[model samples]
Target: MYSTRSSKILFFHITIISLFSFSIVKPIQAEPYGMAGCGLGSMVPVWKNDIGQVLAATTNVSFSSQTFGITSGTSNCTNDGIVKQKMAQEVFIAYNEGPLELETTKGSGERIRAMASLLGCPTHANELGKLMKEKHSYLFAKSNLENEFRSKEILVRLKSQIALDDSLKYICKN
Candidate 1:
């Protein structure tokens, strides 16, 4: 028989392990899938239900087709989508930080035009440039300047400002 102290210690260990496991659990994604996501297993019509997740998982593990699909952009896997678009926007902003700053301050530039295109507002580039010019200080606040994710912060602020503007909100796709 275990001592009372040993029992308490075991309970504590189990509690901590359970908490850690919950913390590491991924949130459900937008796309519907069983335990196995976007692969040959997911494509199998008979095993589409929640209860069939075990079979799907087994199939995915057995074939390793998910890895191939993600890499090759096949089997319902996407190479370009919302996530990639956001990353591309962040990267573009980071690379053109100096140019964008100058263009925004002046309310126009080729870089600003390119940014508008990236944002899915190519036709409204002039309006976007004007908005950016107006919110230049807000978009590049000193606090934001010191951030590690400055580009992302800038994009957020820019989108926020566009949303606030009646004219831009309807025109900008993003």
Candidate 2:
């Protein structure tokens, strides 16, 4: 039993309230990959090991040539000393050798860049390349050694969890 003017006023008030509420109700984003798997204490070494592997793979060099720790006991870099040393080796290779490999090199891991190039995803490969070329930080997800090289299946799951390109195009291809 409200008048037309009152009805219009009520509608305007409700619309304003709804817009305000929507503005405040933002979607919760998943934490970045760098923050997910590792802690501050473990960040430096893990990042280094990861960058090293990428560099070695890019240059077609054996992981052993770089003197990374590989204990017969476990597949993990359990010791802090080993982890730090491995990361240092990675830093050296990334800074010193990455450009040389790109200029005149043929390595198995170069296939990653080749495939990306074919897909016209050279930008993606370049970003990955820059990660090796630059310094490490907590925000640097690509340099996260363990997670970056995980099996494709696991990577898909992880990416989906973070809502990062949740498409299954790469997974279901026979």
Candidate 3:
């Protein structure tokens, strides 16, 4: 019973409504909860748009500090290590919120991981040990502690972010 022009108008209205709904509904929130459950770094640049600017700036600072260290010797490493640590701290400050921030305040695993990744992935276990000993005290009390802080941070953040209760738990196997 509908005319051709009426059918075209109905199609146009439906298209406009769907597009508007999409613009506001935020599809990224539906990303696998496993991704956002751990840390803001895994979520922000992926789920949200505004945080990329902060990430970009932090990346630049990390690269500059890392490059500066490479140009010098041990002194360069020391300076870069210090800068890298600070840069990681700043990134944590910029990205962290809610319960994740609370867990990091206790100790900073995500920050340490960010710093470790910035430091070009150490080759030897001893070297990694040395860096943790010399650099990332905020992350661990000892060089042996890499995942402790982040595990707790992620658990708490995930609990709240995903609205899970005593019935659920999220632990990273890796």
lDDT measured at residue 102 in model 2 versus the true structure, 0 to 100? 46
For model 3 the local lDDT of residue 124 reads 28
Candidate RMSDs in order: 18.5, 20.7, 18.1
The candidate that achieves the highest lDDT relative to the unseen native structure? 1
Question: lDDT tens string, model 1, 72-120?
Answer: 5676556576226566567567667788899999999987887887787
What local lDDT does model 3 show for residue 104? 41
Two-way lDDT contest, 2 vs 3, winner: 3
Q: How close is candidate 3 to the true structure, as a TM-score?
A: 0.20
What tens-digit string does per-residue lDDT give for candidate 3 at 16-114?
999998889855443432211222332334533445545633543444432333223221133334334434433333344333334444444443344
Q: What order do you get sorting by lDDT, best first?
A: 1, 3, 2
Model 3 misses residue 117 by how many Å?
A: 1.5
Q: In model 2, what is the error at residue 159, expressed in angstroms?
A: 30
TM-scores for all predictions:
0.51, 0.18, 0.20
Question: Local distance difference test, per candidate?
Answer: 0.77, 0.36, 0.39
**lDDT value, candidate 2, whole model:** 0.36
Which prediction has more favorable lDDT, 1 or 3? Answer: 1
